[model samples]
Target chain A: MESGNLSAGEERFRKFSVYRIVEHLALIACFTVLAMTGLPQKFYSLGISQLIITSLGGIDSVRSIHHVAAAIFTVLALQHIITAFIGVVFLQWEPSMLIAVKDIHDALHNVKYCLGMAGRPAMSGRYNYKEKFVYWFILLGGVQMIATGFILWFPVIAANYLPGQFIPVSKVIHTNDAMLIFLLTAIWHIYDSIFNPEVFPLDKSIFTGMKKTTRT
Target chain B: METVINNKSGRMGVAAYIVCTALLVCFALPGQPSFAASEQGPRKVDKLFGAEGNADEDERNQCLKCHGEKGSIKKFPDGDFISTYVDPQAFTSSVHRSLRCTACHKEFSLQHHPERSFRNKLQYRIKESHVCRDCHKEGTIKSVAVHESLFRKERAGEAVVCTNCHSAHAVTPAVGGNASTGEEKYCLRCHSRETKMDFNDKECISLRVNIAELRNSPHKNMGCSDCHFGFSQENHPQRRFRYEREYRISSAEMCRKCHFDKYSKVSESIHYNMLSTGRLDAPTCIDCHGGHAVSSLGDNRALAVMKCRKCHGEVYDTYAKSVHGKALLNANNKDVPICIDCHSSHSIKNPSSSAFHDYIPEMCGKCHSNPTLMGKYGLSTDVVKTYLSDFHGMTLGLQRKEASKGYRPDPPMAVCTDCHGTHEIAGVLGADVQVLKDKLLKRCQKCHSNATSNFPDAWLSHYKPSLRVAPLVFIAEQFYKIIMPLMVVGLLFQVLLQIWRYLANR
Candidate 1:
């Protein structure tokens, strides 16, 4: 399976499959567009925000584009969870994205190591606690956005059965949650996956399908 | 000998040659002709002029060859070109058709034509116009009031040319009416150019009129004297205005003579109220309809809305951002309501008045009541029925009935604009709504001064009470629908019918 391959330059391990890379790329494409089109509407009075809206093709076009991107993201998220579940059940793939007691201990151990209380930091597996946290945060956030977006699109129909206040409340949450998810992607996800000293420069496994071999 | 011939002859002989050459050049110059020849030139000219002159119609027709060509023009460096290309048809058809060319032009001939210099065409025309006095005696010229005014202006150093108004070549017989519009040609001659007149308050107004605009206007069939009364060839009233505004207001008064119906309606308007109260900025007839640029606004009521934009610029901007405004302005959807669609053009009511306040709901209902218009946008036609069921609408309905019967009504009540907005109405969806909670709260505070954030919720913005939205209201309505009717019928039979049976048994 080429799981333990020594590349030309450095020792490498096969990590993300081609399909996994494609999924990541799809998520990135839709997430970037959703953030770009959605955030400006929340801060519409600003010149730069207005510029983005106009550059993206006025409010109507931007809204249509936003809905399309959100639909793509919703489909990708649903498939990601379902595929992970199927792989775990049949193909013996590890559910590494889930949190565990070891991950919690590893976090505490890492804190001790930082303060020089422990001999070394706790060892981790294919997916670390930081990575799992990011995955779960995004997966749940995507669901919330999808539910709220559909409600907003057909508000009158929604209000026929549900409370009308849910529409405005959903609107407010959608605006805020977009900003929250954007910051997580731009800062925490970027830092852990690329800028971290452990994988300084870039992780590159998401693109090249090879991750650095580490000692456990 | 060569030195003497070259030097002395080149000096003293050159001097003598120069003197002789100067004398010959001066005598040859046409502009500064020899005074003796000039005297004889005019005497010859005088002999050829008028009916008694030997120069006949044959001689005039002979000269028409050169004058008939359009290229026969004399250009002055400082001013306009003088066209010597007289229309032969106009001259032959003119009242002076029988006269010779020498009759008016006493200075020209085919052989002895002299080059004359003048500052401008006005000066040239003024000189030629003096010849008119030769045939028409002083008493005859003075008989015409306009002619007397022109003579006075001529004496006062103004360039009042007789040929400027009455063309020398195309001098048609004046119409017999005292002040006929047939004199339009006479007025158009001078007025068509960039003419101006000074008012008493030192305001110089453009007296120029675009003949093309007049020809295209609705008044094209009518004569100039029809509206501009007391002004014509025979009697030009010496009208005076204090300022340009006064002149505009005074000129607009002339429209009332013809359009008395519209004028009377305007007098009942708020604009007229302002005008009478010395608010000079108030628009009169000419302001909206325009003076020379007037055109019919027609059925596209949105086009007429632009006239109000001059004074209500910010209001128009707000309206432009609304759903109705966007439809009317951006897409040219004629079905959408515009400014004058609600506010009558001439009899515009004061919006702040209590009567107008009550009238606004009806005004909005004009279009909103149409199920086709409402359903087109997925808006509910039940809004009118729902609004009528509300507290404000019920009171407003009764108050209107009382007012119809000549009764003084109650205080101001809430209308469509109070909750929805006026120029900024964005349909039922409120597409531009940002923090509608705060907005609704503010609207609620207008009535309930101590209202909190939750106070507006009491109104419960539901078109119809659904179980999900207002369950309490829905339950109460269901109870009313089922129980209230049952109780009413039961009481009629149990109470009234039994009492009638007991009375019969007794």
Candidate 2:
């Protein structure tokens, strides 16, 4: 990795490996594809929506495809969680990323700094308050999506235990949660990873776990 | 630890992949074939006088060779064989054998005859029957004059036509006297001036027209004489025409004379009040029962629930898949309310009748509120109770008899027919959610401008003590009897246990 100044007047930048960039992009690609294919069926006109529907053969085929993709995403998410836990407990590579009261202090201090009451920047770690917020949101949205997704995938089985009413409720939850996930990714992930000046153009930490500090 | 974890995870992932792959493969398999193999090839015809390829000449020649056995030995001057058969039995048996065979089979030669094919000429002869007109002009004139004199003057009465009274081959006296009644000859045999009519001209015309029209109508299943009684030539006696110009009498009287069972019931119904008392708008038996093609309701051609839906548009559309609709279609159970049951077939004056207005609850209550009635038919009686308790029903109750009399007093007055169905009164317990969801919205929308998710709750007038046992109410009553007491008892038992423990501890 190329070296960069901690606080720089110099235009120095850190380099990231190709593998980390690809991993994050791959996740974004699949998630976006799934959302685009699934959401329109419930909300939009069947005319144009039918094209995407037939791309997976038919409505039933689309559903099956969606389930398969969801299972793959779920497996990937489980792997990510286990990797995260392992990295935290065994490797102890980034203990600062762990959530703590410091995040609240940092948020307040940042607000103070913005208001010109604070003197300097709070010593931020790899995961800032904003990044941490986005991270937890993905976890919640992902788990909810998977849970409701399974309920819908096998409705007869779900109906056996749940009330007949839960089928439609699950449908609403799955659809809304999916839209929320899509929107959150578009606004939060895309903005931070590619649009944010600090990370501008891309972030590769998902794969390499190497730090990338931009000249500021 | 990392190596062990990686090894285990890798193995697990591979196994999972294999299982998923197998499942996908199973799902991808095509469906089993549904059709059976049909026997192949076209069917063959089996009959004599049938043609094969170039078989016409073979048949003709075979006929000629047998008939011309005498002409086989000697050759003619034209070097063609001539054949003839002079059977001894031919003259006695043949109807036209007095004339020479050459007269009929013109151009008799060894070869096949020309100008007209022998087969064509034979067919023509068979088709024409006979040429009696060719010889008898004055005889025809005398016969015509006799018919004119008897029929035109209305003096003579007989059943005679030329072919009926006379046989051309053996012109002998047919019956040798005045014809017997049950002769069963062609129509001309009795339709002549000599025949006596059982009915006056107008009566006969009306009967004939009505029967003929009915034959062409939907009620074509009925035999002609089914309506007309005492119809025989022996008992033929002319009667005056039965016409009621005041009522402009309906054809239903004819139908009612026989179908008294259904007719009597329909006559007493609310529908009859509208018609009998000059409410010309109401449909009578002929309207739904079918005038010409009167068929039993069980027949495929009979009226369906959708037929009622045509007039009762909104209700029918809503109740398309209601339990009643399904029952009507699936079981053909007329015991379940049809258009007539709820609306009253004959006396169906107006649904707005004040007398019958409050009677709807009791009316619906008859079947719906009755547990035993519902049980026999496997239906939920709760519909009446639920509907009465429902928002629309409550509004209708609020409106009282006034709503039944005039324009729907409440915008969305929930009637029993509105939710459950008019003709079909199936309950919601077994109905699909789609139907339930629609009925819920539609029932509310009848009153509410635009009922949305936040509309006032579906007010079902349930478990009311006033309305009689509609199946729904009966079920509710059962629930009250069994469930309510159990719940109360269970709560009481819990509270007693808690009290006992507390008292003992104290």
Candidate 3:
């Protein structure tokens, strides 16, 4: 028995370009605009806000447009989830994405190997445990945003089941979480996936939605 | 190789490529597909026009047919746009009768009318009233004048927009049944979140507050618009509506609105009467109640006391801290003597009113003579009973005019201030010398310049015949206790001596 002949490893694992990074940046820009327009109106406190409200034409109009933008974001999230599930279930790839005890041992080994005490650490196939953790965190944060957002949007219904104080708490969580997600994606996600030395300027996997497999 | 490159396989490859491109496009688009509408053009203008009332041949022949005959009102239900009915008299009298309606209402250019909800893409798209100022450089809207005045008077920002307050089409009344009713309706429109008033996303809520509670107050009955000027029912700007000195209207003008009689009397009275000569010390209504939290003078006990305390702060603070204030607070009795008791509220005459002076002892008498109150402490009611019997009280009771002279400028004549230390009083045994003996001569010396030990006793005013002193009577009792017993013993001794001499001779 023999392993099936594989394509050249370097050729199959092609690096990402700057264009894909720019595209993600444009999407972030649109997301930021949506957040700006929505949050300020949510916390209106004066007459000038009425003018802003009127400029949007009305509250109902702003709400409708805001929901439309949110739907776009939701579609993006669903696509990411479906792609990850497909990668895990159908392809049977990237076993490091699973958080087994061995992954934690390998992570510690990798850190020791980087400090030059060990010659080399256990090398795994694709999707490091840290990246997997970040991906899971994104999914959790997205779900939290949607849940708390709806609660804030319709406080009267929320109050029927939840405590009155939870309304403001939900609002605080929603707003602060939105800020946190923006920060995490900007700092950690962008740095590691695109700007890190290993990637050397960009990663295209998020947009292209496919891995360049080495096996031919 | 020839079989693999056949037309069927080639067509299938092309179809696959096309489907892949389509799927990529769908993925990139994500959601809603939006497109910009056509840009609106400028309006049409008529070459020949005439005054509305006077129709030239062009106006009569070209315009009047569909617009209705010469003087009749034109009721147009349809064209390319919604039919607008223009009154003939209004058009004729208007300043722009020489120009056709199409000149100003630029979008209504077509023969057929547009839908009811059709936005006039031309005229409505032009900038707001400021845009009009571009061409009409010589003219100014009345709102500009009002805005300037508001800025100067209140230092406020523009609250309502120009269009919210004024109409370009016609002179709209401030109130109407179809639109806003008055200032209230206008304010409520934007203030309510339900209404489309707050255009700027300012959270102006229509909090239902009562103005009725402020009636009969000093600020009452003044026009609300006078203070809240430039404030419309529409989306108003958030300005801090303060009652500062610059925005302060004269108290006399405010009071005269309702209290003409009171204003007239006060104007002649010392407060206003003295104010005209540049005496700035005269107190206004604000000085007492303070303009903001002016409560009812009749019912508000705190307000009533605070009013007096404003001018007489030092005296009132001491008075309230005294036993009188404690009694008044505990008992809720008006007879416990507040500031107004000694100095009347409205009719506070000079400090020398016989009713005021005569009532001093009587006012004190209320507490002293109440057996339940004073008797509990074993205190005497004779203070009131004998004060009335004293020469000073009798003099005050009989000849109030002459008794008035006694209370004139001197502390010695036995006014309430004489013994009570005016504001601070203590018990007779307490440290207050005026209440005690130390300062008795000093007070008595005010009227009787040479008063000494021979002067009329100060303690005798309320003196009762208990174990306490009465100079002459106390001396007589001392002599009977000591001297009379010695005299009796001396007489018995003399008798015994004479008897002894008779026995020796026998």
Candidate 4:
């Protein structure tokens, strides 16, 4: 809303809300701690793993730290879901992150432009195809990790109704999803934000909650 | 002139023949007297048990002829009676039947026998026993400290003698002479006697052996000479051992001859190591089992613990207070291990050794993992299995597995003893859960220097993951299992679609 009164020479648009930015920061912090503590347990024999574990005071300390981080992450995720639900239902806000047919078209058009088959780039709104894809991936991955993490954390209670096999199944899923998100973040999200020529150094819009725009 | 020369040469040849015959007669005359003397019967004795005329018969037979009659007695100036008669039949049947009487009594001769003068028969016997060294050689006899100490000048009269054990007329060959029976008979001659074995008449040496006990031992069939090297009927009491310790230390050497493999293993044991450090009380072979009365090490497990308790009384007391030892005593549990089960019998190593450290987990696991065994005591058998899955357990297991392949894994992995303790393992069952947690926290802090109070909660404490026990962890694990594969496959398809679109446009 502040950008609405901006002069012609200097124009910008608001992207992320303060609430979203805070949530993102929380996610980053929790995810980093989780990876730092959890990955060592999986690859425990590595020298660096042992170093990290010992520096964190040992396996028990690492595990405690991991559980605390996981708990924080789960709470943040729940807050996000609650915020999204309230915005969509109570405030009559459009769920822009929801996938639509136009997103697919836009993806195709963008691919054509990348291949030099189109004269113009596909039009994007508040979120681009890449941004929507990563957003959805993060939401889905967070939900899955939270569910399985809770199962592993309270296996005795879960096994009351669920088959015994589910315990080990949850373990496998937790490990694989962890690796998947790590690879996705490294290869896709980092490349789009930091490594791409269009946003070479970094995409500062998320941090500042504003994006530069051109007025025609 | 030729006839005169031939007559002169014949006269000179006759004179040379007469001179050669006279030289032969002179040479034969000296040997003929002795030859004529032997042809006569046994020479007559002038004085009994005294210096007398020479005998014409064989020296051994001539001596035997005078002493051959039974019950022939001689009275001395001190009113002491001496038995001069020897049993000819017993002498013939003896192991030394082929030997001459003068072999042991070199001072005695037909013409000049030394006058025997001693306060007691033991003194005279000790004096005469010096003749054994002439043939036996001091170098050979001094191989044992017992002989060296007894043969010392100050101990001369008190020393054991050859004639004290071996009969003068009937000395037996040490070997191949009914050795087991002979060795027992010959050794017991001085040993079984209460008065004859008095050393310097000060300490009455009770060299008595319980023959029945010895005969009942596992070494019943083995001869005494088999173990007592350099022992013989002629040298019956090989050494007059002054100290029991010296005899025990020397006799242990004989065990190595038969139990070479066990001896070699024990040489590297902690017991042997202690001995090398000059701990006189440290156990040797005889300390655990009696030398002559050694019995079989039967399946009585408590015997080993008792043997170890003889020296390690304090450690045994601590162990007796432990859970395992209490279980053994209270429940009469044969399955419970004693000292040998963990430390081993002959090849015991120091507890601090790296090999012993690595071996602890598996050694504990041996019984702890047996479901049937643990179930009897209401203990969970999954302790080892659950531990192996934990981070610390996994590291230790990996290190252990790697070590088997000859890799010296990193030290200081948290093993069973690191938590439960090496000797003072208490019953954790029915203990207050919070107290146990506190104890575990303390254990964790040993390695985890910066550990918090909440750090111990991370350990599931041998509990396997189940829905009811760890519901959150179980659900989280399950959710990821399904979602991960779907996400991976879906993402892979999207990647492929993007690649195709780029390729198609190109």
Best by lDDT: 1
Error of 4 at B162 (Å): 6.1
Candidate lDDT values, in order: 0.67, 0.48, 0.47, 0.66
> Can you give the DockQ of every candidate in the order shown?
0.00, 0.01, 0.00, 0.11
Scored against the true structure, residue B291 in model 1 reaches a CA lDDT of 72
Candidate 1 chain B worst ten-residue window by lDDT:
B26-35
Report how closely model 2 matches the true complex, as a DockQ value.
0.01
lDDT winner, 3 or 4: 4
Name the top DockQ candidate.
4
Candidate 1 lDDT over residue span B234-315, tens digit each: 4555566777877888888889989999999999999999989988788899999887656787776676888999898999
lDDT of 3 at B504: 38
Per-residue C-alpha lDDT of model 2 across residues A40-131, encoded as one tens digit per residue: 45543355665565454544445567777788778767777787789788997465546789898986786565445666546666577767
The predicted structure with the larger TM-score, 1 or 3, is 1
Candidate 4 chain B weakest lDDT stretch, 10 residues: B39-48
Question: Who is ahead in TM-score, 2 or 3?
Answer: 2
User: Per-residue alpha-carbon lDDT of model 2 for B1-506, expressed as tens digits?
Assistant: 12422466544543332222111111100111111111110001001112232433443344445553454432334454322443323221222223233323444543554443223333333323234333222223332323333333333443233332332222211211122212222122333224332333233222213344444565455443455444332222233334332222354566777778877777776657656687665556665655455545554311655556655677765555556556655766565556556665555546665545556776878887789887986666776766654334543554453333343432334555554445444565556956666666676556454545323222323433323523433343454456445544543443344344334444
Candidate 4's residue-wise lDDT over B30-80, tens digit each?
112221211111111111112232332377567767777667866655567
Candidate 3 lDDT, A72-183, residue by residue in tens: 6666666656866897889984544566776677766755554455665445556655565556656677777777767656555565566544554464556656655655
